[model samples]
Target: MTREASPAQRTRALIIDAAADLLAASASGEFSTREVCDAAGVTAPTLYHHFGDKDGLLREVAADRFSRYLTRKQALETTGDPVEDFRRGWDMHVEFGVANPALYNIMYGRRIEGRTTPADHAHAVLVTMMRDLERAGRLRMPTGTAADMVASAAVGVTLHLIRTRAAADDHLSALVRDAVTAAVISPPTVPGAASVTPQLARAAAQLEAEMPHGSVGTLRASEATLLREWLTQLSVLGRMAGGAPS
Candidate 1:
């Protein structure tokens, strides 16, 4: 058998795992340096040497996890129908929220914790999607502010899914999709405009390949599948609302 690692390597491994747990357990409060040291069974000097400082370590973890999440989100396909995309997007929101509850809470309400870093990439993606829908003439509103509403509602729906933890039924995704559909003001599609596009599968395939390294790739595959199933269920929402793929 191979020899065991040295003490230094062991310490680093311990810190990383502890940090992950701490991150998962993290709420709207800041974890003091002393608290981290106590939790990790390491000294402050060791943490400082390994990660510079507490804030530095937290930032590092945030950057890493945020990158991973966006990388996964970027891999999602629009499925050719703007309405369907929104439905799928809502599902993605909930799954992402449920899968990474800690990160979701952090990003959603970091201000409460006084961690006020602007997640530029995330805002950019939201803006891009909103603008794209507007260009497609999807918003029923006279103005182009519907995207903001959609983003807010999406986040709300995500929080609802996280907080409401209904019975462990198989159709929870369906429930979320329908609920989200009822919430959004959908696009107007002249008859037959909502048909499936040939570009969808290809686009989805391209998205999956973007995050090949780390567990991000496998995780995204699950997210995509969950999103698709959610879309199918939310079709009821589409019929009830004035949109496609509801």
Candidate 2:
């Protein structure tokens, strides 16, 4: 069985669609509430009643579009290698930004306080990928630190491409991606590897990922907690001292 949208929902969708069309056609990425009301054929009070304010309307617009972008990313097939998947994710992010300059700016360029944006959801996906790399002994830094580095660099590169209109510069995106990837990923470990520090760091990371949250076997819950902290510290220290090159 199919359920139809209420009149209110249809009106809200109409407004959002109108705003999105205007935003895409806008050169400066700026629009007035009056313009939106005109485009949607809605009264000012009706617009305000639905969205509260212009900023609220804009936030909803950005969230709606960015959520669609995330849906495509989520549907992508993983390449088994988390590193490769991460590279693909980075490229996709830049592609999305270049393709939707106005919407991308709204999504990432400004802060929308007291709300969860799709950008935050995208970062969480990156963090989860970093953790996967950590568990595989491929990551060199703390998962959170690595995620932050990649997210910051990717966003910066995307914004630069958007502003400079150099969206076709694949070399520029690749150069930055490779640089950041090299900084955070370790070379594949060989059996009986000679580098002790990297090996130790990988061991610590793997153990940390596998560590039980509560008591297991002879270990108490408190002991497991303490051991997890120590492993994390060891991993961080080892990476700080320099791990294998990517």
Candidate 3:
């Protein structure tokens, strides 16, 4: 059986839920602390006691709502193929962004320094997926670089869709996803004559990914750290050689 929340927990939850409702209903996708307090049937002091400030309240609300969204996202089963999983992940991200514009904006649109959100979990999932692709010899770039490219493009397209309130057919999320995949994933090569550069990049990326699994072979922790740093540089060398930033 589920345990009941304490009175304090209950009150905090009430405040967060009220703020989320206000944020969702507001034209600007924001709400004042006074508004949230009033909506929650609490005074400013009570709200501040629980959340410290308006920003804290909003951050909590965003984290709560994003966590719920992630719960649903995590429910989707993986298909074993990393590429297909990434396609589904991209689709889910765009769909969630479009469906929950206010929350999406709060979760991803705001840029704050030194503050992490529940959204970081989503990015972590992407990085792990990229690592899987690297291990499979299908990645064409460093895992971090590929994650950045895919995330930037996906978020940019989703934000455009949100701003324009584009119709289903007009949304170019799939096209953008496909373009990113083509740019970062190696196409299946024939039996012979595969390019060496992508092979090198993939090997470097795979090694970097494996480093986190702990000391490789007989390497000490310090040695593994240095090796990872070198692999990171090597992973991006091919792109640098081709005039892209390392």
Task: Please report the candidate that would top lDDT against the real structure.
Answer: 2
Clashing pairs in 3: none
- Where does candidate 1 clash, by residue pair? 234-246, 238-246
Clashing pairs in 2: none
User: Can you write out model 2's per-residue Cα lDDT over 1-246, one digit (the tens) per residue?
Assistant: 879999999999899999999999999999898999999999999999988988888888988888888888889888887668777888888999999899889889987764777789888888988898898887867999999999999999999999899863568899888777766776554444343388788888888777644345698555665566566656665656677312
For model 1, the superposed segments whose C-alpha errors exceed 4 Å read 1-18, 25-56, 112-120, 142-144, 164-188, 191-246
Worst 10 residues of 2 by lDDT: 187-196
Model 1 C-alpha lDDT per residue in residues 76-186, reported as the tens digit of each score: 765887777766666666676776666666667553222344344565676777677657755434333655665666566666666775322226566545544433444
Tens digits of per-residue lDDT, candidate 3, 74-166, equal 898889766687788888888888877888887689853335776676788779888988988778679999988888998888889989998
Candidate 3: regions farther than 4 A off: 113-115, 188-246
CA RMSD for every model? 14.7, 11.5, 12.0
Error of 2 at 175 (Å): 0.2
Per-model TM values vs. the true structure: 0.53, 0.75, 0.73
> Residue 153 error for model 3, in Å?
0.5
lDDT values, one for every candidate? 0.59, 0.81, 0.77
